[model samples]
Target: MKVVKVNLAKNVAKVDIGGTQQWIRLDIVNEVPKIGDYVIVHAGFAIYRLDEKEAQETLSLFEEMLRHEAPLH
Candidate 1:
């Protein structure tokens, strides 16, 4: 997912999960994240930040997996 917005005062961030907008807590992450940064989220918390190249590759893999699975549903 990609961080699209950050509310430092509130320790919250809005991230883009695929095409969906999700709000996650920034307090749990080791470092603060900024907009346009990719992050790893779990249980409504941003757990880690990811580099752009890695994030895009991961997203690509997920898209490929979904494409392969789409015919089943």
Candidate 2:
């Protein structure tokens, strides 16, 4: 999930995975993500937050990888 909406008081965040909203816990995150942050959720928890440039680059790489896989498979 990239986009995030956090309710820090409740220690939960609704993240946008594709177009759907999924809730993830912030208990294990150490430093919680802000409203506009980009994060990676693992096991229903926010584990990593990526900066804007990193998020863009990682997404670009994923898109490139998808394009490569589609033709080969």
Candidate 3:
């Protein structure tokens, strides 16, 4: 999902999809990602924070997917 906002003090993030908003907590076990950085979120947890290269790759993949079809889950 797309990371819309990051709350560092709470270690949580606000993600949005199709106008639906959700809060995703960051895993304390993983390195804390900075604001504006994107991570792979699952359920309520941020499983893995993406590095620069990975984030770019992921964004590209997302764009490709969006180009193919409407976002439906």
Model 3: weakest 10-residue lDDT segment is 27-36
Sort by lDDT, best first.
1, 2, 3
What is the TM-score (0 to 1) of candidate 1? Answer: 0.84
Q: Per-residue lDDT tens digits of candidate 2, residues 1-73?
A: 6656778789899888568889898887746788877887789988888877877888889889888785544
From the highest TM-score down, the ranking of the candidates is: 1, 2, 3
Pairwise lDDT winner, candidates 2 and 3 = 2
lDDT: which is higher, 1 or 2? Answer: 1
C-alpha positional error of residue 9 in candidate 2 after TM-score superposition, expressed in Å? 1.7
Task: List candidate 2 stretches off by more than 4 Å.
Answer: 70-73
Whole-model Cα lDDT per candidate? 0.89, 0.80, 0.75
Pairs that clash in candidate 3:
none
lDDT of 1: 0.89
**Top of the candidates by lDDT:** 1
Pairs that collide, model 1: none
